[model samples]
Target: MREVTLTHRECVKLIGSPERARYGMVSVDGREPRRLTCLIVGDGDLLIDLDRERPIERPIAGRPIAVEFTHHDQRGNGGWTVTGLGLARPIRDGDKPIPMPYTTLTVGAFETGVRVCIARLTGRRTRPTQI
Candidate 1:
């Protein structure tokens, strides 16, 4: 379970293209983690289409967030995890909550978030456990 730092190239490789999508762990303002997935698309900029069982009413337009994508090999092979940073508008700028049902809320506490620019990514190599 010892975490290891990965190079830029390694990070990109682990996070394959859109075709090879997997869920990532997302947390805003160090809150609880939620499940989300998206393609690497481009370098340095990460955009997440966040989904929740229920809508959130807190302000998140300009809140700092963290995301982690992980993989574990069941056959004793080494696996890795990637963590990234994000950005958004001022929290108060878009504090108003977005109405639910059929509305697209961007840069708020309900729907989408600003581009998560992960300029640099670190890695965590997973150690296989003995059953």
Candidate 2:
């Protein structure tokens, strides 16, 4: 496995495209994993919407966060591991505090690569990690 870092623009481009975007299972420094949908707004802010059943006990905005996942190459020959790390920012809902399950992230860097062979496997899109 190799480490890859993504620039803000690169991060935006990846998340901005619907075809490239996938629901990510994210954890903040080893916290319980949560389902998160990420997108880059036109203004270049990376928005992360969390799926949660309960209110957040504390503010997570400005906290450091990382997302780990596997993505297939265009040809589906191999799986490239990706990890996006950034600082959680806040998104406003017009006078309402940012909801418990939503956050805005300023993507600072990411690490990906060192492809793992999975082409021989069938019935699975990508191997799951124990994030």
Once fitted onto the true fold, the runs of candidate 1 whose alpha carbons sit more than 4 angstroms away are 1-4, 17-20, 50-59, 89-113, 127-131
**Candidate lDDT values, in order:** 0.57, 0.42
lDDT of 1 at 48: 50
Model 1 lDDT per residue over 1-131, tens place: 45567877777778763333456776777888887554343563444544432333246666776878887777767788888777644323333323312222222242443445565777767665545
Model 1: lDDT to the true structure: 0.57
lDDT of 2 at 127: 32
Error of 1 at 79 (Å): 1.0
Q: Name the 10 consecutive residues with the lowest summed lDDT in model 1.
A: 99-108
Compute each candidate's TM-score over C-alphas: 0.61, 0.45
Q: In model 2, what is the error at residue 118, expressed in angstroms?
A: 29
Q: How much does each candidate deviate from the true structure in C-alpha RMSD? A: 8.1, 13.0
Clashing pairs in 2: 4-111, 4-112, 5-110
